[model samples]
Target chain A: MITVRDLAKHYRVHERAPGMANALRSLFHRKYKTVRAVDGVSFEIGAGERVGFLGPNGAGKTTTLKVLSGLLHPTGGEVRVDGHIPQTRERAFLEKITLVMGQKQQLIWDLPPAETFELNRAIYGVSPADFRETISELTTLLELEELVKKPTRELSLGERMKCELAAALVHRPRVLFLDEPTIGLDVSMQVVIRDFIKRYNERWNATLILTSHYMDDVAALCPRVIVIDKGKLSFDGSLTDLVQRIRPEKRVVLRFDRAVSASEVEMFGKVVERTELSATLQVAQDAVREAVSGALARLPVADLTVESPPLEEVMSELFARSRSEREASA
Target chain B: MRRYARLFAVQVRASALLAMQYRVDFVIDGMLSAFSAGVALIPLFVVFTHRTSIEGWTFGEALVVTGWFTLLQGVLEGAINPSLTTVVDHIRKGTLDFVLLKPADAQFMVSTARFLPWRAMSIVTALGIFVLAFVRLGRLPSLTGVLLSLAMLVAAIALLYSLWILTVSAAFYVVKIDNLTFLFGSIFDFARWPSSLFRGVVGFVFTFILPLALMTTYPAEALLGRLRLSTFLGSLVAAVGFVTFARLVWKSSIRRYTSASS
Candidate 1:
């Protein structure tokens, strides 16, 4: 549904030193440095596919989303969303997509979210019947029937975010660009949002590209992920593939009936974490069974489970690797 | 045209809902608009109490100018200022992305984003002033005069909206223009008097540079049945010119929208 080819957005930012004299002098004679927010990143998302956009801070994830949503004009390269040039911001293109920013809101503060939703209905020119159906479905799914009637300012952050999502979806957009949609929510709220997103994608066959700091969101909702680092596409594959490429090790956890000696745990595999009651072992994919059997035979194990390395660790490892590779190339 | 009219109606309804959201604020705002309209006439009362006329326009005739000023002030604060101020806030906070994402004209969206419904009290007050002015003159406005004055009101509203748009557009580049808006408000205060009261540089600037004459004085002259057809046509031309220029500036500036980091 979305195609981006070598999309680059560069910004010329003014520079200055910290001192008063330098600040004064810099005003008279300014220097600008071009920072490539997104440089030559190309990716395509198919219909009804859910893709996670992964990046560290300032990794151009948001910039890429903005360009895709047609908020920011790409400095170079071509971008089309569902067949229309995004920068042109044609009405049909806009009617087909929505971008939800967790940090920023579209809700009218003083008015109830219902008012904002109604306003969006008018702006998008949604048919009255369709508008009614969308709002009823969204309110039921989001559990926002009560919240919509309250002023937006009075709603909690998570509640406001739910309303924000509902507001963005009033038109039933076909392609969704979600930029950190669960940034500041609690764990349960995060789960609710992720579940709602997954349901929306499934029910409507909508294409979704989500960027979130919360990895569980990616794990739960997006089966495939596109990792971007330093405005470059570092990895693009399924979640399992990304985990395998970065970590390639399974973590085996053993809960001990009694306190276990560290030496006994070390013989099985690399101990990622250890405590008096349990130890986590990082074993290669091929050695996971052997390690589990050995740990059961040798260690005081009451319970055991094999799981992949945490998404956070895998992502950090991938970013660190990408940074080092750039340094090596330089 | 129909789509825009529908959008406008919805926006106005939203504003009305917002105004009534805080019940006490609604009543207070209504009373305050009426109170401020009364307060706006004090200077006119003061100046006229001392002289029968200034700049060859009688006290009653000048009241027409003040009435238009009050009405335009209502237009400014109620319809124009609130939305443009929100546009400024949207730019600063980077929430304009939501506005631009909508399947509508961004200019129309921003222009109609907000309104203070209570400020309509000033329009009512302006009507009352016009009636009072005509009563003091011992005659009613002719049909042609009323028709011409209504046309002038449209041009005045266009000019005011266009000027405010230009002012708010500066915020896109500079990031803040609170002082500029303040200066605009203070300068707009001069429109309450006849545009000819100040001659030389000030008069030239008001008539041509800033077009304060086009905003209020010519409209007042139209109401008084004294405005020349040529001057009325000139103001209409100026109104169209300013609106087109403002739209172009707004569009180009939107391209420069390196929207703040989300």
Candidate 2:
């Protein structure tokens, strides 16, 4: 559904010193550096597949999304969405796609979300019947019954985001480019948004690409993850594959009947977290059975469960590794 | 075209709902519009008392020109002006992404997305003043004169709207210019007085370069049956030229846009 070939978006950013004299000098003769926001990154997204675009700050995830959605013209290479060049922004191409930025909004501020929804309906040329059915479905799914009528400024962030999602989906776009869609929301609200996004993708077979700081959102919605750092593709595969490649270990979490010392748990493997009643240890995946049996036999393990390392740690370690590798190569 | 019309209708409805929410603001805006119009007319009244006409225009003819200026100002403040700073805000804040993503003409969406309905009150006041001037003159315009005047009025609006688009599109490059509309407002103020009031290069600039004099003065002249055919054709050509130039500038600006994300 989307093909990006050696895409690059370079920005000529003005550089200046902090002092007033430098600022004044910049007014006459400015210095600029070309920051490659997205440099020669290539990826293909199949229809109905959900993909997570992962990166640290300044990693070009949002830049790629903007290019795909026709908001920004790519500085080099080519991009096609649903068989149309995005930068041209042909009406047919735009009608099949939607870009939702969590920080920004399309809702008319003083008016209700319903008004913006209707406006989109007109702009997209959606029939009244389809518009009504879509709005009804979205309202029910997003639980926006009372929220849609109130002015957007009166709603909470979560409520407004729910409305934003509804407004974006009023046309039932086939490709969804969500940039930080769950930013700044509480845990449950984030889960709600994540679940709603998944359901929409499943129902419409939409090509979904999401970039989010919240790892949980990515985990819940995207099965395949693409990681980028410093405008270069670092990793692209399943979430499980990413975790396994980065950490190559499992977490052995144990609960005790009584208080236990940290030293006792350290014998099994590397201690990740330790407390009086509960502890977690990082053990090699190959040694998981031996480690669990050792803990069960020696320690008073009331309950024990084995799981993979937390995704956040895995991602952090992956980024740290990438940064060091880049430094080494330089 | 039908789709754009329908979308514009929705924008109007949305703007109207927003206006309804600020009822007190509507009242305040009405009062301010009336007060400004009254204050503007004071200078004209003072000048008329001192002399029967300024240059070759009679007191009634000058009032007609002021009425047309106020009417155009109302249309501008109601629709076009509301989008000026908004375009800058959208560019700076990254909200323009939503506009570009829409399956419509971005320029049309940006131009029509905002309006202040209460500002239309000035148009009504201007009409009242125009009718009063016509009654005082005690002569109705010829049919041809009225037709030519209406055409010129439309051409003037097109020229003004095109100029505004040009100004606002510059925001894409110079994003920090928050009050770019102030420049237009200053230039538009020149439309209140007749072009003949200025002489030499200044008159030439207002008449042909900025075309501020053409906006109101030609329409007034057409209504008074004093407009030359050459001037009428020149105003039409200027309107078309400005609109085409503005559209080209807007397209190039969009192509040059880097968006706010990077």
Candidate 3:
């Protein structure tokens, strides 16, 4: 449903030095530097595919999403949403896609969310029946019956975000570009948002491209992941592939009945973390069973559970590796 | 076109609902609108008291200009300023993304995003001023005069709205335009007086460059049956030209809108 080929969005930003004399000098003789916000990154997302875009701060994830949603004209290359060029922002193209930015909101501040939904209904030229159906569906799914009636400013952050989601979905957009949609929400609220997004995708068979620093959000919703760093595509594949490629190891966390020595755990696998009563061992994927059996047999393991490394640690390690590789290449 | 009309209604309803959201603000705004309308007339009353006529225009005739000025002020404050000022805020916060992503004309959406219903008090006050001016002159406008002035009223609104669009389009590049808008408002103060009050370049600037006369004086002159039909037609054409040009500028600004950091 979306195709981006060698897309780039470069910004020519003015440069100004600190201190009085330099500031004055800049007023007359200004300097300009072109920052490559998104340079030559390309990817295609098929219809109904929920893909997660992962990156650190200023990694061009948001910029790429903006290009796909037609908010910012790409400096180079081509982008198409469904069948229409995004930059043209033809009405039909816009009607087919919706962007939800968690940092920003579309709800009318002083008015009820219903008002915004009504406004979108008119703006998108949705039929009265369809509008009703969409709003009803959104309210039920998000449990937004009471939240929609109150002024947006009165709602808590989570409630407002719920309303924001409902407002964006009023037209039933087929492609959802969610940029940090669950940012700053509490864990439960984040889970709720994640679930609603998944349900929406499932119900509509919508194409979804989500950019979030919250790894849990991506883990729970997106089966495939695309990673961008420094305006370049660093990784793209299934989440499992990314994890396997970055850290092909399993974590065996053991709870001991008594204090366990680090040396005892290291005999089975590399000790990742440990405390007095518990220890975590990083064992290679293929040898995880042998390591767990060894640890179980050797240590007084009251309880043991094997799991994948935390996604946050895996992502940072991946980003760190990419940066170091770039440094090495340079 | 039909869809836009329905969309307009929805937008206006949202603004009206917003206006009523805070009762204190609604009441305060109503009071301010009335007070400002009275204050706007004070200079006219003071000038008329000093001299019955200035440069061939009697006090009653000039009151017609103030009347149209008040009406356009209504359109400016109620319809134009409230909506367009939010464009700067949108540009700052990057909320303009929501607006651009909509399946509608971005210009129409932003231009109608807000309205202050209480500001309609100025419109009522303008009508009152019109009635008083004509009664003092002891004559009603001619049928043709009324029709011409009505057309001029439409043109005046178009001119004012287009000028605002031009000012707002700057926000795309400059980002912070609070002072520029302040300068704009101060310059707009020129419209309260007769367009020909200033001589030479100042007069030329107000008449041609900024077209303040097209906004207020022409409509007043048309109402008083003192305006030539050709002049009215010319100003009408100019108003439409300004609108088209403003639309072009707005389109280019949107194209240049990089949007604030996400």
Candidate 4:
């Protein structure tokens, strides 16, 4: 439902030096530098697909989302969302998409979230019946019964986020661009938001593009992951594929019946972590079975488990590799 | 359009709730405005009380001008200023993305996102002052005069709204600036007096270029049984042109938007 080709968003940012002299000099003759916020990046998201956009800060994931949603005009690119040019911001294009930013809000601060929902209903020109039905569904799913009536300021961060989601979904947008939708929420609230979002996508077949720092959010909702770094597409594929490509070693976590020496744990493979009763060994994916069998026979009898490396470590390693590649290319 | 109206209506309701949240501040703002109005009128009332008229306009005639502007500006501030100035804050705070994503015109949303219900008191005060001035004038406005005045005032409001849009559109380009609207506010101060009171070049500029006079002078002049067809038609034409020009500028500014953060 979204196509981006050679997308780039360059900004002529005003450059200022520290100290009084530079600040005063800037008034007469200012300096500027071209900051490539979103360099040449290309990706496509199919309709009814939930994709996680992963990147470090300043990696242009949010910029890409904003460009797709028409909040920002890309400096150079061809972007089409649901067959409409996003920058043109056609009314029909807007009706099909919603961008929810966690740090910012659409709710009317002094008024109840219901008011914003009503305002959106009117602006989107949703029929009364549809508005009622959609809001009811959202309320039931979000458990927003008590929060919608309270002013936005009075609600806690988690409560306000639930209401924010409800407000954004009042029109039943076909494309949902969620930028850090669960950033500040606690663990349980984050799970609630993630589940609610996944359910919404499944039920409505909405095109969901989520950018978040929380790895669990991505792991839970998005089967396909697109990784961008330094305004470039570093990786784009399945989450498992990314993990395997970055870190081919599987983690063999073990528990022991009796205390064991570090040297004994190291005998299994590369001991990632070792303690008296339990130890974690890093083994190649091809050697995972061998490692498990070896540990079962050689180690003190206990429970053992095998799993892939954490998403966070895989991503960091991938980014480090990308930078080193750039350095080598340069 | 119903959508814009609905959006603004919610803002009005929201502002009412906001005012209730800070009732003491609302009372203080009202009292301050009333005091300022009384103070500004004292000199004019004193000078004209002893003499029958000033510069061929009677005390009551001038009071009508003052009262009309006070009312019109009260409405403008209550409805327009709060929301209008917020465009700058939204830009600085990076909160404008919400408005841009809405299906409605971004210009309309930014122009009406805020409604200061406390400023409603300005409407009441202005109306009271206008009625009192009309009572003092001792001459009921003719049918034609009333029609001309109403038409001119509506045109004035349109002119003000268009000007505001043109000014606040700068936020898209100069995102860090927080107080660009102050310049527009200062320039609009000239609207307090009738256009004829100023001399040749200044008067012409006010009537045509900036159209500050169109905001109040023309309306006040029309109500004083001095409606001029040329000036009225000129103000109407300018209002239409300004609205169109404002829309074009807004479109271009939106085109220039580069999202704040990656």
Candidate 5:
């Protein structure tokens, strides 16, 4: 549904020193440096697939999303969504896509979200029947019952976000570019948003591309993960594959009725964390079964669960490795 | 075109609801606008009291010019200024991404997204003043005069909107500047006077370059039976040319937009 070929978005950013002399000198003659926001990145997302775009700060994930959604014209290369060039911003291309920024809103402040939704309906030329049905479905799923009637400023962050999503989806876009759609929400609210996004993708077979600082959101919604660093593509594959490639160990979390020694926990594998009532061990995936059985038989355990290392750790390690690799090549 | 009209209708309704939410402010705004319109006429009143005419224009004719100025000011404050200012804010805060994603003309959407319906009071008062001036003059405009005046008035509005679009488009490059309308406001102040009051290079620039003179003065001249066809056609050409230029600027400036990251 989406194809990006050698995409690059370079910004000519003005630079100046901090002191008064430099500041005044910059007024006469300014210096500019080219910052490649999105450099030589390429990826494809199939219809109905939910892909998580992951990167550290200043990594160009959001830039890629903006380029794909027609918000920003890429400095070089090409991007097409649903067979239309994004930068052209043709009506048909825009009708098939929506970009929902968590920090910024489309909702008219001091007015009900319903008004913005109606405005979108008219702009997109959605039929009344389809508009009604879509709003009903979204309101029910996002639990935006009375929230849509109240002024947007009066709603809580999570409530406003639900309405924002509803407003974006009024036209039933086939491609959803969600940039941090769950930011600043509590855990349960994040889950609600994540679930709604997944359901939307399933119901419409929409292409979903999400960039989130919250790894849990990415884990819950996106099966495939694309990692970028410094405007370059570093990794692209399934979430499990990413984890296995970066951190090839499983975590055995054991709940004990009483205190346990650190050494006892280390007997199964490397002790990741330990407390009086519980312990965590990072075991190689190949030894997870044996480690679990050994811990259950020998350790003072009440219950246990084995899982992969947290995505945060794996991502950090991956980024660190990529940075060092770049430095070595340079 | 119908879709744009419908979308604008929705925007007007939404903006009206927002205005109603602040009813006291709406009333105060109307009173202030009326008072400003009255104050704007003081200079013309003084000039007329000293002499029955300035530059061969009777006091009644001068009143019509001020009336057109007030009406244009009302429209600018009520619709154009607010919308263009909001575009600046959108660029600074990076909310323009939502606008670009919509399946509509971005320029049209930005230009009509926000309006103060209460500002219509200025237009009404200006019309009342115009009618009162016509009564004082003891003559109704000829049919051709009225038609020509209406055409010039519309062309004036088009010119002003294009100028605003061009000014606001600068936000894409100079993102830190907050008030892009200051230059327009200053030039619009000069527009309150008849273009004939100024001569030589100043008059030429106002009439030809910025076209602020054509906006209010030419329409008033057309209504008072003083407009020449060549001058009327020139204003129309300027209007069309400004609109085209503004669209080109908007198209090019949007390419420089770097949306805020998530």
Candidate 6:
């Protein structure tokens, strides 16, 4: 449903120096540098597929989404969304996609969300019947019965995010580009948003590309993950694959009936964290079963669970590795 | 077009709701606008006090110009200014993505996003003043004169709107040019008087280039029974030309916007 080839977005930003002398000099002759916000990245998304676009600050994930949704004209690249050149932004192309930015909003601030929904209905040329049905379904799914009528400013961030999702989906778009759609919400609210997104994709067979700082959001929603760093494609594959490749160690989380010596757990594997009655050890994936069996017999174990390294740690390690590799080459 | 009309209707309703939320500001805006109109007319009164008429235009005739100026400004402030600034704000803040991703014309969406219904009070007050001035003049414009004036008024409004579009479109290219709109605001202030008052280069610029005076002056002159048919038609043609040029500028500007961060 989406294809991109050698996509790049470069910006010529004015450069200014601190201190009075430099500031005054810049007033007459300002300097500028061309920064590549997104550079030569390529990827394809199939229909009904949910993908997570992961990157650190200035990694160009949001820039990529903007280009795909027809917001930004890529400096150099070819981007096609469901057979439409996004930059052309034809009415047909727009009706098929929706982008939800957590920091910004489309709702009319002073009025009710219903007004914005009505405005969208008119702009999208949605029939009254379909508009009614979609709003009803969205309200029920998001549990937005009382929120839609109140002015947007009165709602909490979580409530507003829910309404924002409802407003974006009023047209039932086929492609969803969600940039930090669950930012600033509590855990449960994030779960609600994630579940709603998955259900939408499943029910409509829509293609989704989501970017969020919250790793849990990516893990629960996107099966495939694309990682970008410094405007380059760093990794692209399944979430599990990324975790496995970045950190090949599994975590053995043990609960003890009595106080356990931290030194005893260290013998089996690298000790990650430990207290009097609890311990965590990082063991190689191949050695995980052995480590668990050893710990079961050695430690005062009451209960134990074996799991892969947390996604957050894996991602941090991946980013750190990429930066170090770049530094070494430099 | 039908969809735009429907969207505009909803925009109006939405703005009405907004106006209700700030009723005090709405009332204050209208009063201030009327007071400003009164202040603007003081110079004209002084001009007429020294002489009953200038170039056959009575003080009452000049009032027509003042009234139309106030009326058009009210409409511009109430509807066009709010919507246009909303466009600029959206562009700067990257919120314009909402409008662009919608299945509608971005220009139309930006042009009709916000409305300040209470600003229409200024238009009503201007109309009252125009009627009062017309009654005091006590010379009914001939049928042709009235028709010509009405046509010129429309052309002038179109001309003004076009100028505004051209000014705001610069934001797409120069993303940080908020003060660019001050150019139009200054030119619009010149429309308070007839274009003929300023001769030579200034007259040529306002009449032919920007067409600022063409919007109010020609209409006011026609209503005052002093407008020549050829001059009125010329102003109408100029207004249409300006609108077309502004549309082309808007298209080019939209092409220049690389969206939010790109």
lDDT of 4: 0.84
Q: Ranking under lDDT, best-scoring first?
A: 1, 3, 2, 5, 6, 4
Tens-digit lDDT track for model 2 on A120-239?
Answer: 889999999999999999989999999999988999999999999999999999999999998999999999999999999999999999999999998889999999888889999999
> Candidates 3 and 4: which is better by lDDT?
3
lDDT of 6 by residue, A1-330 (tens): 999999989998889988999999998998999999999999999999999999998899999999998888888989999999999888889989999999999988877888888888888889999999999999999999999999998999999999999999999999999999998999999999999999999999999999999999999999999999999999999998898889988899999999978677789889889899998889999998899899888878999999888888888899999999999999
True contacts kept of 2: 0.85
- Judging by lDDT, tell me the better candidate of 1 and 2: 1
Query: In candidate 5, how many Å is residue A234 off?
Result: 1.2
- Per-residue CA lDDT of model 4 for A97-165, tens digit only, reads 898999999887877899889888878889999999998999899999988888888999999999999
| lDDT agreement with native, every candidate | 0.91, 0.89, 0.90, 0.84, 0.89, 0.87
For every candidate, C-alpha RMSD to the true structure in Å: 1.6, 1.6, 1.5, 2.4, 2.0, 2.0
- For A1-330, candidate 1 gives per-residue lDDT tens digits of 788999988888889889999999998999999898899998888999999999999999999998898888888999988899987888999999999999999999998999999999999999999999999999999999899999999999999999999999999999999999999899999999999999999999999999999999999999999999999999999999999889998999899999998998998899889999999999999998899888888877899999999999999999999999999999
User: lDDT of candidate 2?
Assistant: 0.89
Error of 1 at A329 (Å): 2.5
In the range A1-330, model 3's lDDT, one tens digit per residue, is 888899988888889888999999998999999999899998888999999999999999989999888888888989888989888889889999899999999998988888889888888888999988998899899999998888899999999999999889998999999989999999999999999999999999999999998899999999999999999999999999999998899999999999987777788888888998999889999998898888788889999998999999999999999999999999
Q: Between which residue pairs do clashes occur in model 1? A: none
How high is the TM-score of chain A in model 6?
0.98
Candidate 2: segments with Cα more than 4 A from true spot: A259-263, B258-261
Q: Which candidate is the best by lDDT?
A: 1
DockQ head-to-head 3 vs 6, winner = 3
Chain A TM-score, each candidate:
0.98, 0.97, 0.98, 0.98, 0.96, 0.98
- lDDT per residue, candidate 5, A1-330, as tens digits? 999999998888789989999999999999999899889998888999999999998999988988898877788897888899897889899899999989999899998999889999999999999999999999899988899899899999999999999999999999999999999999999999999999999989999999999999999999999999999999999999999999999999999988887877888998888887898889999999999999889987899898889999999999999999999999
The digit string of per-residue lDDT tens for model 2 on B97-165 reads: 788888888889889877998888888889888888888899887889889999998999999999999
- Candidate 4 C-alpha lDDT tens digits along B1-262: 7667776776666667777878898898788777766665676677876998766777777777777777766767878888877888777777777887777877877777777666667667767777777888877778888899899888878888888787777777776545667777777766666557777888778767887777776787887778779888888898889989989998877666544443
DockQ-based CAPRI category assigned to the predicted complex of candidate 6: medium
Please report the interface RMSD of model 5 to 1 decimal. Answer: 2.5
Each model's iRMS: 2.0, 1.7, 1.9, 2.3, 2.5, 1.8
Candidate 4 TM-score, true structure as reference: 0.93
2 against 4, candidate with superior lDDT = 2
For model 5, state the Cα shift of residue A182 in Å: 0.6
